[model samples]
Target: MSTATAEPAGRPEGAEDAQGAERAEGAEGTGPIRFGVVGTGWRSEFFARLARGLPDRLELAGVVTRSAERAARVRREWGVPAFLSVAELLAAEPEFVIPSVPWEVTPEVTGELVAAGVPVLAETPPAPDAAGLRALWEQVGASGLVQVAEQYPLMPGHAARIALVREGVIGTPTSVQVSSTHMYHAVSLIRHTLGVGFEPVTVTARAFTAPLADPLSPKGWSDDLTPKDARTTLALLDFGGGRSALYDFTDNQWWNPLRSRRMVIRGSLGEIVDETVVRMADPRTPYETPLVRRRTGLDLNLEGSEVRHITFDGRVVWRNDHTGAHFSEDDLAVVELLCRTGAWARGAAPEPYPLAQGCQDHLIALAVEESARTGEAVATGDEPWSA
Candidate 1:
């Protein structure tokens, strides 16, 4: 994985250097990259909030909402021009546009934007189903203007682990177990940790259901504490050549307070379990260390409450560039995706997360679901984007 331009100090070894990278920021020397939003839903607001929070790096030029009332509310709340159509949003001349609409509508909107020759940072699972994914790929896969907003790899903990894996701290990752986010997001993490690309996978999965108390959601906590039956899906993805990933996910794990995210990346020399790493440092002895995070605003630190950097065995693996903004782990990941997308759009860096990669992630995720539903293994062969 190539590092983006304008990376902070303490980047891992073998990562790309920012010094020789081109500076093609549109009309502004190192100024914020201008972008537009094409929805008024919960996820779309993430982009708007990021633009407002990091004014020095991002600027929201306009937005496109479905209704006049929603457009008016967005304009009043976000203080950006809200339009009714993508064409009107394009008139703002944003360098790129983000489509955060529903699953079924995403590919259509993305195709429309691609037809206009505009760069797009689409939301996760660019299409709803396998057929939709195939159709969307046939339409826009050839166009290099589409990049998916797959930000899980950009999360601080995952970023740190990916760095260590790339630095050979774990020596050729063989398998990964992810009990974190669902579907494509987890697959993305698995691929990054294992360093596999476009490999065919055979997935075997099963789902179990149990009653659990779930009072939290995207809308916040509810008064009802009733226990509801929740489904947990477990999958084994065999990526061939002794590479595999274990995928585990529960319903509403993203916002449930009771469930915690966990990961284990196993390699020949060592393995990383959550934050702790156990590896052979020398032929005679084994070394165990924790990935420590430098978080400010603990007791007497005046630097505010935010993660500064992550260190493993006295070396910085990941450093936060937007430290003072006080973002959560997910927020940090999304912001990093936005920054990298900006660089890629301006030709300063490689495409952050291309369409094919996103397509593959979703294709595998869909296979996981199919295997779970059918109680049989599903083999995901090459698709149009596999090339």
Candidate 2:
């Protein structure tokens, strides 16, 4: 595994750095990397909130809203310039713009920015439907300036898993079972964990619905005994060479604690069940230890707390830019995405999540849904962007 760039610090993949690398963010640093957002919607708030939360590492250069009224509200809340169009947002000279609009309109917004030569860190599912996928790919696929924010694999826990898998600690990772996220995001983790690059695969899926108590959501818990039909999908992706993945997810799987968020990685020597790893310590020795997370500012501490890093057996596998800052794993992942994008735009790092990878993830995800709907195996066909 190569070192994937993280921010304020570069997070190289695989175990600890040979040089005993430590976080190098100065006790102080420059103003955060300046970037802009193109929408004022819910998804776009992550970008704005990240910049606002990490003042030392990011700066919200400007925002492109749909109307002057929304722009005014945004300006008051974020204390940053807000524009009604991309042209106006470009005037501030941001390093890039994230087209965080609806899936239906994302292509147009992204195409507009790409035409203007403004780099983009696009939102997920770059396009909504198959036609849109092909059209969007042909339009900006060759631009080399767009990187999608497929941040799941970069999430702290997943990053630790990948880093450990890369070191052969599990001995040739063979299979992955992901129930944490849906389709594309799940496929991303499966392919990454198996070390399979944009490879073709056969997918068989089935969908079943059952009457279950409606679980609580951010919107609020449902009234007790209110039964809602819940869809459960199970998908099998065979990548050949006996490398495969099983994706199990229920509707709103992300929010359903009753479903039990989990991952199982099987290897030649053993397997990993969530935080615990049962693998060979040596030829004759078997060892297991829970992945330990070191955090700061617990309980009665006034210094504030944040996830520091995850480790297995005392060896740090993944560390963040802000070691003690207030951030959840997902928050840290998104911050790293923005920072890495800024670095890529400035030629300080490689494209973080390339266009091809994002396209492939979505294409596979589509196959999952199709397979589930038709009650048959779906062969993942080559798309225009298949490399």
Q: Residues 1-387, candidate 1, lDDT per residue (tens digit)?
A: 123322222222332223213324342436788989888888878788988888999999999987999889998988889999999999998888999999999999999998988888999899999999999999988777888999888888888888888788888899999998999999988887887777789999999999888889988899777989999999999999999999999999988988998999999899999999998867988989999999998999998888888888898778888877898878998888888878777767666788888888899999999999999999988788776
Which candidate has the highest lDDT of all? Answer: 1
Q: Report, for all candidates in order, the number of backbone clashes.
A: 0, 1
lDDT of each: 0.85, 0.78
Model 2 regions lying over 4 Å from their true place:
1-31, 221-225
What is the C-alpha lDDT profile of model 2 across 1-387, one tens digit per residue? 112522111222431221112211211224567898888887777778777788877888898888888889988987889998889889998877898888898889889988987778888888887788889999998777677888888887788787778777788899999989997789888877887766678999999999766567767776565768999999999988999999999888777656778999999878888888898767899888898887778888666788777778888778766654588888888888887777666655556777667777888889889999998888876777665
RMSD of each candidate?
4.1, 5.7
For model 1 the TM-score comes to: 0.93
What TM-score should be assigned to candidate 2?
0.90
